[model samples]
Target: MITEFGLSELWEPETRRDPHAFYARVRAAGRPVPQVDPAGNRFWVVARHADVLEGLRHPEIGHQLPGLSHGEGEAERIASRQLISLDPPDHTRLRGLVGRAFTARMTARLEPWIAEVADRLVARARELGSFDGVADLADPLPVNVIAQLVGVPEDDRAMFRAWSATIVSASDWDGSATLAFAAYLDDLAALRRRAPADDLLSELVALEAGGDALDRDELVAMIQLLLIAGQETTVDVIVNGIRLLLTHPEQWRNLRDDPSLADAVVEETLRFRGPVEIVPPRFAFRDLDLAGGVIPAHERVALSLWGANRDPEVFADPDVFDVHRSDVRRHIAFGHGIHFCLGASLGRLEARIMFDRVARELGTLRLAADQGDFRLHHGGLPLTL
Candidate 1:
């Protein structure tokens, strides 16, 4: 019998194609594997919806893992300088300062511009007939939007996109790439200091002057995190959602018939094939009970957002991708609690506009070739449409 959370033979191709079915097997056991990895790490996989929620809500489980850094424990280098890296009182203060920048009103105000961008992209896609969704659609839109918000110039978007990619690389850090990125950011900060604009970066600079505290290091970290977070995962959501819909023609038709369903479809797609398959690893601040096991302090806890979203106890027919599912919003695709994604609203808006514009402008959009194989960026999604 396969023990709960037992290491199985499925880890290889599953990482390449789909990990959902594999997670279903573990979830069927109704408990996380007693201990998934070696090193006698006490962490358990939380596959049940209830268990995931419990783990996410637990106060003892914090996001302060010390050993997560690479290359001789570069703790000072990798930790996010933004609000996300901070735990409590500091987190609350920084988040409060930046909350107004991402308000619904502000995002809504950008709708016309976003729609225009979507329309232009869709028109370009039609001209090409077939394009890699990852490169053409999923990758660029969010990068463009976030660049505008952060005061990056139009010509600099390419370099900014490359920098975002390098910083978020799961493999070894590219020294030249990383240093160039850091230097660019330092220059950007100095530019803002010299002549501020009416963007979020400028606003942050002003805030810094007004006693809202964030040093140069913190600012660099915040900029890097925002650049990657604002663009990368969002591109994954759009690409993955499009891939699934194209394969499931019926669901695609459901959205085509009624554009109002696009929002719910976005939510369901996020549940089905979200970009951040797992939540960022967290540290056990103290001994904590999870999934019928005790996780000792100093150990790491990884949350499977993908697994939790598809738990049958919470979602009926969890494996089936259904846009009409009434419980779609219950999914933890955007996560829960204090560390929930800050740019979620912007992501949704981008998705809705992109889907609508694509479906409307490109009347006969479909997969380019059945035999073409696509690549997945570890913990990321890709599509060709």
Candidate 2:
């Protein structure tokens, strides 16, 4: 029983600096560890790879808890409708409608455009001689790609980027950014309705499923999920990949020697230090026995992606950052089951293009200065060409 550990510890500066040790302890306990967050929410944290996988696919666990009230407010209402917050039936319906517009085929067609965006960003960074990896390459690449795909105009992208960063970071405590984003989407939806364009927003605005279409709040919520999840997770993967390569000079050389290894780097980074620490909280619909432990009905459970990815039983030398690992595909950084990331293909395309460009064009990169310790959420990474 890992009684001393609590979910709130993950937010501590020291834990954020190096959380795997904490995860290792949880895994060694061999069952889900009961914990309460700062807000007094009691939940179980499932850490082992098998357990996490089971939790993800368990039919008894879901996002929507029965009898739970999703507060009534503009932001809360929009959040309630977001794809991530719903369960089957509603989740199935909304995902089906949105999926049509964000298909794998659509993502494949954007490869050339994504590569061009990467080339331009890399070229500019090379010309500058020194640049922040996050700002110059990682951040802008996904932001531009998703914005273009969603039909957000060039002029409004900067604002969207700002809003996305604010919302993801949870710095917009007053809900100002959420309201602003909702208002902007309202206007954008109206415009697309009046004159449809060859972009996702237009497709979504006109999308229909069994004589049903996305209502206003649903549209705003869907776009909100896409913009934030699309931009934020990809940014972390790219930046973390670059950081890993630069830190591991030998791997960097290997990638530079063979840019085809860019895909390998993306997979390895996700396994080694994936963006998400855990998937969103899930509720147990009934008392369930998992890995020899029981979760009471109506309790929340957090499936630890970080813990599962580094399970020693699954990945040998799990802590080491090697881009050539064979089992990297097993990592569920984009999550698993029904809530698996929809923008995953786009995220992969963007990261692969950026990593490939860095290897072929940039030649070699080194940190501009000592960056002390790495936190999962970082402002930027300064690097020199």
Top candidate on TM-score is 2
TM-score of 2: 0.96
Candidate 1 has a TM-score of 0.89
Estimate the overall C-alpha local distance difference test score of candidate 2. Answer: 0.88
What are the per-residue Cα lDDT tens digits for candidate 1 across 249-342?
9988877787777788789988887877667766778877777667677676767888889988889898899999999999988888888888
lDDT values for all models: 0.73, 0.88
Off by over 4 Å in 1: 1-10, 14-16, 34-43, 65-82, 171-175, 371-385
lDDT of 2 at 153: 96
Off by over 4 Å in 2: 1-8, 208-210
Query: Candidate 1, after superposition: displacement of residue 200 in Å?
Result: 0.7
